[model samples]
Target: MWFHGPDKMINVHKMDRTCMALSFLSFDRKQDRRKQSAGAAGRKRFSVDFPFEAFTRDIWIICVSNVVGAFGEGLYFWVFPLYVMSLQADYIQLAIVTSALMGFAALVPIPGGLLADRLDRKKIIILSWTPWIFAPLIYSFAQDWTQLIPGTVCWGVSMLGLPAITAYVISSVGDEKKVTSVLSFVWASYSFSYIFAPAVGTYLATIIGMRSVLQISA
Candidate 1:
């Protein structure tokens, strides 16, 4: 529902272009490897000439991507539970539904970490959105509590990218002193994305109904 603002839409487009540019601009870790070894024959394979250099271009790209996504999510998340209640779901059903999304917090980080180690961290962040693409679609079509499970599960799977995302951000900062503040700033972008989203969502939900908003989010 909140996605309609022309200003916000423009911001999303600009951010996307920025991410593309940043991706091309980022230094290759492999190239760094060659430079390190060429500079010092006896130096360790992973030694750094400049520790702050560990912070990579991908982190900037990620922060931009986060802003775009968090904007849409800020529109949908709180509205969803109220939508379920609108469906006349009972307390137990509500608990189960909420749990369906939360449950993945325990299970996904292992695979997320492995993926972080094995693949391009930027790509991991991008790929994480795939599961979320299905969530709004499922929510659009769901008529009952059981049908909501799939969307929530997809939402959970999207969260699997957190470990990879965190690692990238932390590595990019390359400063222990600044890590916590960096993380807080990154996460707080979600709050910043939608100052008016919940109010807009409530207004839209009242008029067009909740399912329509979910579809818009999708």
Candidate 2:
């Protein structure tokens, strides 16, 4: 986390050491930690397997949270560029707007990682939800393309909590073998929501048009 910013750090040599250090600093469950040491200490699994205890309460919390977040993003993630195009933003303006949103996002991960280490990961995630609350509203009410700058800003700024979300799930359990398994679960959980959410968003778009869909995303 210190070195990787918001990027996954499971590959870093210090990741194990970091995990060990985090385990000591975090909650205790000797029963869980004992299970972690028996298998491969550091290997990433791309697929989810039943042998891994991947459906625990904490994991579900992350899954559910990811679903809700993904669902919200899904409503607009695909339609956003189209919506901006509807605003008639020229290529140059669109490029600038996209850059503004993405540029801020890149800066957030560094602070996000630092905050993940210093603060409660759950709380950080909870706080991160605040931007989504208003971001859609900003999009819904914006009368002109320029007004969307703030809306895009909120979406981009939300990247600040990404590291905390990733770190929270990996560090939730002390086992290294389980880390990759949990990572797979987390990826699946967040991704699975997209399968349904986009369809739902499309349905709603037919009923209310794109701008109102942004409001519902809130």
Candidate 3:
């Protein structure tokens, strides 16, 4: 009887230990599941809020190119009036030049839209951007304000790509809902260059001449 009593007690203890171990394992699994769910929720929230998925490969490439182009243009565009005055342009001549720049840019959109619809958008963008490279070079070599007319025209010509860029960006995204965010992101990226390029340009112009800066920007 004494041996049987101890054996029952030991068996009961073993059963209790087994139950406790099972409970612990179950609790651990639940904890792991909870952690995994929480992590997944965090990742999902991040993806929804950050617009990361909207930046597809083509969009990213365009954003990078926009930054570079904006920076290059900003380097001299802000100080363009001063550069004009330095070239002995009177207020009237400056106004004429500015008007010509704006007028041509405004007019190009009509044909630009047609071209964007008919031509390969990528090629349109490339062709339009080509004028900008030469525009600043023209500006750098100008002897007088009259000579800047061609440069201003070239700058205006570069606006021909604007429609193509917008159309290309819209077409590049698979998700329609992400279009606004993606476009805003791209525009914001371009604006980033203006924040710093003017300061850098001013500093460089102090070290080098404005013409040299324009040449460098070109």
Candidate 4:
């Protein structure tokens, strides 16, 4: 092999270094593009995959309130007939009481829908929840089956808030496309409270008594 001139060797070395630098620069550019793409994908995933970002503050408040209300309701709803019977309600009386509850619950929602359309939904929700608190207290202090009527009526009236709550949830969603997801999420949160509260309520009733459990539920 012929030896290279020093100048030629130096030039060759410079060319090699330049090629290496160009290759490294190309690699860096590709890496930067990949990072940018990944970042954009991450941002898209955050916006699309996370549903809670669709809810407003009022939606969160409503969700929490519904959870607590559902929990309290679960504490008594399963054992309501037994409690009524304990107050000396006969079979016919029980039927009447349950029928009355159903009647009021079914009928009131008509006006409730009207009120929800006309009134402040938040105030309607608060008013409706107010009666539920008193209903449990009334049950705790009932002297007879007849005395339970007023409390059942109060409980029935609490349904007045349902439409308002539904409307509020729809309004609270920033994206209309997310309304179903938000409502389902909020409703599921409420129902989740029911899974354990009924069992706990029954245990508490056995330990302390049904009336005491009703008071605790209040």
* Candidate closest to the true structure, highest TM-score: 3
What would the per-residue lDDT of candidate 2 be over residues 52-147, giving only the tens digit for each residue?
555568778777878898888888877777777778788888887788888988897799899999999988887887886788889888777798
Q: Tell how far residue 74 is off in model 1, in angstroms.
A: 2.1
1-218, model 3: which lDDT tens digit per residue? Answer: 33368889998889889999999999999999999999999998776656777777877877898899889889988999899899999999999888988898899877888999999999988899899889999999999999999998899888898899889989987888778778888888889999999999989999999999999888
User: Candidate 4 — which residues are off by over 4 angstroms?
Assistant: 1-50
**Alpha carbon lDDT of each predicted model:** 0.76, 0.78, 0.89, 0.89
lDDT of 3: 0.89
Judge candidate 2 against the unseen true structure and give its global Cα lDDT, from 0 to 1. 0.78
* Estimated TM-score for each candidate: 0.67, 0.72, 0.78, 0.77
> Taking the tens digit of each residue's C-alpha lDDT, what string does model 4 give over 1-218?
34489998898889889999999999999999999999999998776655888988888888898789888888988889999999899999999888988898998888998999999999999899999898989989998999988988998998899899899899878798788888988788889889989999999899999999899888
The TM-score between candidate 4 and the true structure equals 0.77
* lDDT measured at residue 211 in model 3 versus the true structure, 0 to 100: 96
Winner on TM-score between 1 and 2 is 2
By TM-score, the candidates rank as 3, 4, 2, 1
Compose the digit string of candidate 1's lDDT tens values, residues 1-218: 45778999999899889998877667576678788888776454334332334445666566676777666666678877777776779888888898877887678778989989999987888888888778878987888878888888888889879888888887778667667666766666667768877677677778987778777766
Q: Which ten residues in a row have the lowest lDDT in candidate 4?
A: 44-53
Candidate 2, clashing residue pairs?
Answer: none
Model 3 earns a TM-score of 0.78
Better of 1 and 3 by lDDT: 3
